[model samples]
Target chain A: MIADLLTTVLVLAGLAFFAAGTLGLLRFPDVYTRLHALTKADNLGLGLVVLGLMLQAEGPAMIFKLALIWVLVLAAGATAAHMVAQRTWTHGEFERRE
Target chain B: MNLLLVAAAGFLLLTILFGLIRVLRGPGSGDRMLTAQLFGTSGVGILLLLGFALDQPALVDVALVFALLAVVAAVAFVRQHGLPEPAGTPMHENPVEEQPHDPPHNPPEDTHDR
Candidate 1:
């Protein structure tokens, strides 16, 4: 029962972050800030979800697999965020800001 | 527990759908591409949740693929479009600094007519 409760909390928290990230993406003023939303909030969202799922995961292999997915996402999300931010910077998207 | 997982999956899908707004109404290509990247990550989350909820471990592999391939798309976009001008030195400020062949010039009269 405790395991299920923990899982539910983690999952809900993760989903909330995802929702916040999406909302930020919609409402943010520019590409750079939007990148902030995607990188930070969404990444955390995925991490928590993975953790929640890991609790109920059956085998060692399944747990490892779930963890691997989170790690892969962390690496990929950070790299992509950097690249996009760099592109936006170089393109002078927000250069005019004082 | 299963129902909670299912609900989580549904919420994630809803977020992905919300992200589509940026993709659809892009003021810039970078924004569109970034939004797509967001989709990729959220999609992975949804897949994992669904996998556990439905008792199918195979879906994890699909999530892995989504995570891996997401980077490829962004890299391709950066390669093709190229980076924007570097910060700190506005191009207008130094027209002849790099391009000697072309002289420092102002916009055409018609362009400034507005």
Candidate 2:
């Protein structure tokens, strides 16, 4: 019972971080800042939530799945953010901003 | 457990809203691209939450593929069409600083559009 409660608390806390990240992504200016916000919170937030849930989960199968999801989050986040930033580079959108 | 999953999914939905707003009202194609990235993140969250609810491991494989695909598509598009610049943006700040540093870009007229 205590463990479940603790995990619940942790999950909720992670969710809060996710919320803050989303807000930062929306409220911040420019692609870099947006990417900065999105990557920080989304990655950590999801990671924590999965960790917290892993406590409640049973068996190696569940644990493996959770871990795989985290790996995907990390890999995908960097690549996509990079692509967006790359687009900004190729388009010469920066010159005018200068 | 069910209630917690539901709550988590709801919060994930909120993240979706933030991304969608960018898609709809973003100043340019690049902005829209960023918003689209949000969808992929939210989708991952949703997948995990669902897997937890169902106690299913197979879904994780699907999520993995989806995540990879989204990033690949984003990168391919960015490399191909170029990022769309937001209108009314200042012409003095070098926006390309956020990008990978490489090569010289030939100067061109400011093609500002709405």
Q: Each model's interface RMSD (Å)? A: 2.4, 2.9
The sequence of per-residue lDDT tens digits that candidate 2 reaches over residues B1-112 is 7689768878888888865766776666776776677677777777777777777767667776766676776776675565555554565256763354543552333445
Q: Output the TM-score of candidate 1.
A: 0.82
- For residues B1-114, write the lDDT of model 1, one tens digit per residue: 888888888888888887888888888888888888888988899899899889888999999889778899898898667653334434436544445564445333212222
TM-score for the B chain of model 2? 0.65
Poorest stretch of ten by lDDT in candidate 2 chain A: A89-98
* lDDT per residue as tens, model 1, A1-98: 78888888988888888888899889888888888999865578998888888889998998998888888888888888898888888767772222
Question: What does DockQ come to for candidate 2?
Answer: 0.37
Ten consecutive residues with minimal summed lDDT in candidate 1 chain B? B105-114
Docking quality tier of model 2: acceptable
Restricting to chain A, the TM-score for each candidate equals: 0.92, 0.86
lDDT of 1: 0.81
Candidate 2 Cα RMSD (Å): 9.9
Put down candidate 2 lDDT per residue, A1-98, tens digits, no spaces: 88678778877877877787778767777767777877865588788878877887778887777787778778877888887877776665652221
TM for every model, in the order presented, reads 0.82, 0.75
